[model samples]
Target: MDWGQIFNSTAGWLFSPTTIAYALAATGLAVHFGYAGLLNFGMAGFMAIGAYGYAISILTFGLPWWAAMFVSILGAVVFALILGIPTLRLRADYLAIVTIAAAEIVRLLFTTQVFDEYTNSADGLSGYHQGFRDANPFPEGTYGFGPWTYNQNELWVRVFGVILLAIAVLAVWLLMRSPWGRVLKGIREDEDAVRALGKNVFSFKMQALIIGGIMGALGGVVFALPSAVVPATYTTSLTFFIWTILLLGGAATVFGPALGALIFWVIMAFLDNVLPAMAAVGWLPMTPIQAGTLRFILVGVALMLLVAFRPQGILGNKRELTFVK
Candidate 1:
């Protein structure tokens, strides 16, 4: 077992575009489920829209990168309205069921053959990232040390992802500190109480949904960075992973999601290498394939333990409003 390999792999996650994307998505989850008392189990749908919207805009209409981004945001807005208009007035559990179903529907729609010309059916979309690459300002060279290093193209994706994640975290922090943020918290605690005080609970919920969905959409774009947007990539498992990230970090805290993202990926990366190495060295009773599966089992057990011991998360305050729905 090579300890050096494990550490290098962990460090590689520090600059991982996927890490940045998950952090942003988790932050968006924090906004919806943690702060707004909405049970949004379909964030994956929003992310799929973001990536697919951007891809379709660029591929079908020859849109620029900025315009593609705009189309993505618009798609998220429309999705939020569609999902929220009827369900926001019903039980929160209804929203959860609707969202999870909606996410699957979106993924399936992309997989259908009817729009093969536009969506490419199950083959997914590629060659849409030229605009992003064209905007890269970095010089042609390798950067970083050992396995943590990347060439200019890869570095550009990481840089773009990091900048977007930073902007998202800052925006969430500012919003949660304002009066509007207070109302969100209030709704989370008890929407009836807020409604009695003349606040439009449904409207507030819709706004939060749209804002959080837009953030998830941005996260989707980052997740597609340096890679193609495949229909299978936006699975419901992705939403659960984002939830784990949000819960691991303090869901209501500003920096918790980002920090949790770093910890989660770094730990996963370390386990990926270390467990396989241990299996190969006969230190573990399992084969390399089994070790790969064991890592997730371990992470799941760890998450369960955290939930029992620190329900508020690493940075969450015991007094802060939590997601009870």
Candidate 2:
């Protein structure tokens, strides 16, 4: 029940790599469901490919960090093509089914024993940090203030993540202001109308998928930077969490996803600390384990309320609500 410890833990998430990673992924989702109105539910699959692709390239192929990152992005592009080719034409619900299943397949393939040499199957891949860490330019020292303090390696990861997030935000902002972005939104609003205008709806959808998938892949790369590439991390729930973040922030807005990610993780971190402490202090009528589990229930309720009361999210334009359209 130490307030100081809880405060520090909560504050750390504000600048955590995981927060940046989720923010990136949510932005990708915003591209899919927000601007383009795609029903992609396999974002986790793209992230898995990025994380494992980077890890395998580094561990087995002896590639450097930048090369490995390229491989990961290429893998995401390939996955997007594969997933989008036959499925983009499907109805939204069908597309969702296909994507969720595809993501599970990707996760299980990594968990299977077939490619254990490269993926290490269930054990996942580790020891791939040397290349990334070696590229750190901060020199050996602790940095930052208060709960944000970290050693050189941690600082490097956070800095790189922030830079990547900024680049993504800028890229999305610019693209959305261009003609191509307008077409994407047009397709989202009325696919047949765009098609009647002689625009290739299918092509636009595919491009959006690939672009968003690449962003999701970048998110995976950032997520892998601070830890091993564990298959369990890319579950269907991860995609849903990304969706929640996307929806929580204003899906169609450029900065909404990042803002959503920051708020979501801060709340999660606060709950992770305060809930168990409350249980321990008999402030809650549940055991510590039950209290820990209750936080997720609360999150679910919060999401439901958000969806019901304000589906447009904090930064979203009410007219941009896909469900209403």
Candidate 3:
């Protein structure tokens, strides 16, 4: 087995665009499920809208990069409002049903031929990041050492992504400390009690939904940096992955989701790289493809163990846990 290659692959995931994207998405889920007690099983829909919104705006309208990003966040907010208006009043399971279905609808809409001109359908979109890339300040040379180096563009992406992630974490931290945040936690604990105390529970829930959806949209934009806006990327599995990150880190904790994302990706990356190398050298008795699949099986088993032993997650407070009665 090539130990150097294995180490490089595993370490590369530390600043990978996928890691940043999942971190942001998990943070958003923490807001919805952790703070607001919302069962939002369709975070992928918000991400899809954000991705398609930015791609289509740049492709068809020729908008500036900043304008396109703003539009994407606005689109996610509007989508959240649409989803929240009729469904927030229903039972949690109903919200889950609507959200998951809505995500699928968004994915199919992007893949439909009628919107091919704007979305490029299943072919996806490119050339939209020229403006984004033009702003890179790093010189064209490799940076970092020992299993963690990147070219100018790659470094630029990671730097910008980390900046965005930091800002998001700080913003969430501040929000969770405010009076509004207190109300959100109260609502999470018991909406009826919050309502009896004269809080606008529905309005608060809608606002939380919008905020969280915007975060997911931002994640979608960053996620598309290293790749094109493929509709297939926003499948139900995407949401499930975000949930896993949230659960892994500790729900209701400000930094749990981000930490969870880092750990989850790191573990997966290690398994992916190491297991394949082992198989290649006959140290493992599996084919390359089987080794790849085996990583996920291992991750699934790990998650089961985590749920069984630490239901509150790495940083979650058991007192904050609330399952619907």
CA-lDDT, candidates in order: 0.89, 0.93, 0.89
Q: lDDT (0-100) at residue 177 of candidate 1?
A: 93
TM-score, one value per model: 0.97, 0.99, 0.96
lDDT of 2 by residue, 229-304 (tens): 9998999989988998998999899999999999999999999899999999999999998999898899999999
Mark the 10 consecutive residues where model 3 has the least summed lDDT.
316-325
Which candidate leads in lDDT? 2
Give per-candidate clash totals: 0, 0, 0
Model 1 TM-score, all chains together: 0.97
The runs of at least 3 residues in candidate 1 whose Cα sits more than 4 Å from the true structure, single-residue gaps closed, are: 323-325
lDDT tens digits by residue: candidate 3, 232-307: 8999999988988998999898899999999999999999888877788888898987898898889888888887
Per-residue lDDT over 68-109 for candidate 1, one digit per residue giving the tens place of the 0 to 100 score: 999999999999999899888878788889899999999999
Clashing pairs in 2: none
Pairwise TM-score winner, candidates 2 and 3: 2
For model 1, give the 10-residue run with minimal summed lDDT: 316-325
